[model samples]
Target: MKKALILSTLALLISGQVAAKTWVLTDTESNTEQGNWHISSHQLNIKSSPFSIEQTVLHGGKQEGSKLLVIKSQNGLTITLIPTRGMDILRVEGFGVRMGWDSPVKEVVNPAYMNLESRNGLGWLEGFNEMMVRCGYEWTGHPGMADGQLYTLHGKAGNTPASKVEVSVSDSAPYTITVRGLLKESTFKKADLQTQTELQYVPGSSQFSIHDVLTNKGDYDHDYQIIYHSNFGQPILEEGAQFLAPIAQISPFNDYAKKGLSTWQTYAGPTKGFDEMVFNIAPLSGANHQTLAAVVNKAGNKGAAIHFNTTQLPVLTLWKNTDTLKQGYVTGIEPGTSYAYPVSIEREQKRVKQLAPGQSAHFDLTYQLLHSASDVNQIKQDIATIQGDKKVEEISTPMAKE
Candidate 1:
């Protein structure tokens, strides 16, 4: 029995459960671990079978209304957000990028439709509002996908320079992403994958970390925005899913297609049968920052709160979309620095934030799951607690970038 116990302990150590391990997968291909599912760094090519988390959104942006992540534990507990035929395929397309219900679903403009882009991946990476080539910025898709495609720091790099792989892990288990070679339009020699941006994760939850790693290797200052866009499926939202946000008005894009709902109005209480909603907030100032969240539902209310420090990012945008056309099923809770409208409009409106060269900025946000609540009071209370004493930040720019 002692020998068996020793062997079991050794096995656990080899399997790497003493602490969580962050593996840096590559952007070009999918990585699979035998029995486990296949995953790319971008998280675009999720496995399809064994009832695991399959990619629900398609490359064409066809599946819009439902959640797409499937999570299966080694213990045989199967939980999915909203898995239907509509939610079966992974969408190479993006939310507001192209062919969005807003106006036209232009494939060329769709970064997912493109085989290559600047950044292509998952978990809340922001895309610039505009496409500027001279700025060394080429539209790849969203920063998540665009960055995933153009650059990747995969594999492990030991301390030895000769043995160092493109990717490396310090004594700390954080997976580090490194970029080598000339960046699109900047000039810098070195950059580190910085996930300084963080969100709170449940202690024992299967999904633990939502992180971001940014680096500037350019000569000129990089003025960009990065956001978090989370796609949720069923299992997480049953018949009575609800959402909440501390916003004054919900407005349609001044540029995109007109209003499906309305441009600017009071926050709708509990939107049951709606497609999506968008809100606006200013840059971060004080230590206590403002945020928005999804409230209650039959399954469970899961959402995140966003906080941005101006030195790194200057704006915050809340994007909520449901596939009313699909089956009234899933919703995407995306908190970004910029809106879906054109960057030209944002700069025209003077809403864009600029990041300087070699300078770094940081922020902290939290994503928590909640059960059914009595009313929107819980949300209001949480917001009040988070933003206590700090003044509510508002949009002061309506001027475009020149």
Candidate 2:
């Protein structure tokens, strides 16, 4: 009986049916799965799936002291997550394609070294190379002064380090890996907020997902905003690439954004001194209030899509910066609670969300990769279905409020 039991255990191990594993890389109160955050560097060699995940601390450049978690799957997926920057994704690579832009900023900038108030409130651009990054727990619009207070470019959520990070794997099939990061924003007399961001991946799939829960812990009600700045460039975003979305209402952000209104959904290769343009879009939702936005390459054989629910994120902003490669060429398909406008404007427009004391809100998004023409076409069809029978309202200029 003992010999048979030993053989059964060996068979389970060989088939990759071992028990689940959990690791706490920075939990402050837990002891069993906790790690010493004070330590400069360490490795957590997680190997329960068909792939691997490694944890290490960077030591050079603005990214110094940043904690980078790299995941590699047998399905050719590579994801880099930075816990030091509110669990923002650094880059994603798979199927001979990359999911990030070529920014002038070469290395990742540690949040501790970033000054969000510098350069006349444009300091947030210093550490803006991530493929996906959160924009706020308070504000995410342009820098301005309101109610005798100065608001910086974007809020502090993306620049705040996570107080706790934990990794766990499912014991069931597919063996998904879940990485959770906790970020807190608080002050003595100001608002108190906490955001728990979870990034999950199936080792052998060409997709990943983000789940975020934000809670207001202040004594009174508080208004907040959030934006998921999902940027893309290079191979998947080129000269003739197209932006597909179920647009119910669309308007140019400013006079400059109207220059390319004729080909708003089309892209240019690269130009010298090409200024950026933005389009404020209200997306149409299908069943269950779900929507999809995509960018397919010129050849229509490769693409990427962002799947989100319009209930939580009611607006989408499309940003195009087809500048020269050296000057950083990219585009952003941003889903957010409000448009990138001043808090006062959004409030007047009734787009700002208010949370009662101790209330929480949830946001979810998924990133998918398409490697074939059929896959890309399927997304286009899905978007078209959402647009059925709805007349698109295209404004020739900015609204009177702007």
Candidate 3:
């Protein structure tokens, strides 16, 4: 009996059946999985399913930090972080999503930003596919005091002292994520302090975690921009893709400016012939914030879906292809930390959230991907089911701590 028990325990450890395995995926090219997917740690690894190739950056190389996972869908959709030099360029070669980076707009110059905070590298949530905050941008081009890339995510840091980020993958699912960070100081100034954002991987459910501790190390109080950049490209947004939002009017960044000027004006109809589409969403109404849908259809085969969250975020930014623009290559269904202005402008517009010396603010949002819908109403019903009647509380869980 003792021998049997010992052998059973040993078997469990070797087979990794009781717990997930943290296999460092590196140096592998794209390939399909007969059953399970592969993970490696070598510089540039590509994992290919029968239908798609998922490439990750072990080395962003020659350029600064382009460290992001690249996905190439079976329908010929591809995505990669643009090099630092192309910071302002949002591109779509085919049916793909290109997340662009713009230099951070200085708050001091604009009086509208008296009590605002500023950071380098796209403001708000411009880095990834989704912005997990109220109003924010994707990527900013500024380097931090330390060598790491500085970014702001959703949620509040408050009195916490430690923070961390983790990401995991399952044999069947695409990705899982979670984040935690410490709030060491009450006053955080973007220019003064240096910080390190670490990535943690563990054996458990195939989920990713990201966490940070934002501090008000600065002398005065300021409202910081909190956003998450969630970028989905290619196969995710194909030719027949559709997006939904609670929008009565669509506006440009600058309505009366040049055609390509970062304008914000009410959108009367579908946006056509433009580089990208960025819109300002209205305030939250009950459970509906906004929804962006995308669909790709070739012949009769169709893949469609919608993306959005609840009250935590109140704006939506959509990008599609016009006659002069590349249609299906990229479509950004972005949620943000603030509307399209500096933090100061947000404050003037009564859109900024204040953070005192010892005070903190908590923000929450969620995103769900859909597979099929009977029609527009059915699709709306599907979203209603996911965003049904639950509020996301900002608290610590086992998934977040790991």
Candidate 4:
């Protein structure tokens, strides 16, 4: 009987059928089966075969007072999501390649400190250092007041806290893990905005997906603007980094961008006193309403790409700030429902979208990190074909409207 039992144990170990150990740490909320996790040395680990999801809360230093969710796949993809910070993605690394930039702000601050009244209320800029930050239901660009009310830079969505956060790991085929949260941006006697967000990571793939739903719970029509502020920094945004997109129309936001429009596809080493440039682009439609954009390093060995629905997000903004190598050197590939203009200007141009009471809009975006030469080459070929087709045009800048 002892020999039979030993053989059965070995078979279970070989098949990986042995139940995984789980650990959980919480202060107020009760843990559920979906939240089954293993905590060791203050790390929350949820194992599902080859993929594991780890949860860690910041205690001290710059990361102090923040809660982060780390997802790891057997294929070497690692993603960190911060639930306390509007559920923004903090970092993405795969195959020894760092895919996001580092912000000068060393510490994560509570969303309560997001001030739009200090120095033009650019406090949001300090915490803007992340892989992806969702901007807006009212305004998203410069700070301005409309109808006797003031709107801060980039709105308040990024600073709003999320509730009902849930994490789940699946053991089925094509194993997957998901982190879901709900962010509500509402005030008494003001507009009501709710955003439901979900981040999904699958094993054996270098790509993940973000699904969001924005709804207006007010009684009247309300202006709405949302942008996926996706930023990429070094080693992906180096001196020779290349930007690729199927741009059908491009418009320079300022004279500086107009002067360098011809070489906008290339990048230069950071220079002192470098003026930032902004370009608004309308992507060419693809099969099933999809659009593509990417940034690849000079060596073309590492890069990141995005696939989004042009029908949902009709505009893309490319922000280049190459001021100094040590600081203020980053690029943003943003997709939004409207241009990154002031709220008044957007209204004047009739570009702002309106959500009626009880109406909701859904946005879906997929991000992929390219770790192999083949993946990078594929994007290059797509860009080449887009340029060769010669279906692109240049539009007048917003200043021209003045």
- lDDT sort, best first: 2, 4, 3, 1
Tens digits of lDDT, candidate 4, 337-380: 87777777777877789899999998888787888788888777
Residue 323, model 1: Cα distance from true site in angstroms: 4.4
Best-fitting candidate, scored by lDDT: 2
RMSD per model, one decimal: 13.0, 7.3, 14.2, 8.5
Q: After superposition, how far is residue 234 of candidate 2 from its true place, in Å?
A: 0.3
* Count of backbone clashes, every candidate in sequence: 52, 0, 86, 4
The C-alpha TM-scores of every prediction are 0.46, 0.90, 0.45, 0.86
Full candidate order by TM-score, most accurate first: 2, 4, 1, 3
- On lDDT, the stronger of 2 and 3 is 2
Which of 2 and 4 is the better model by lDDT?
Answer: 2
Under the 3 Å rule for N, CA and C atoms, how many clashes does model 1 have? 52
State in Å the error of residue 351, model 2: 1.5
Q: Taking the tens digit of each residue's C-alpha lDDT, what string does model 3 give over 73-106? A: 3433332212111111122222222322122221
- Cα lDDT computed for each candidate against the true fold: 0.31, 0.81, 0.31, 0.73
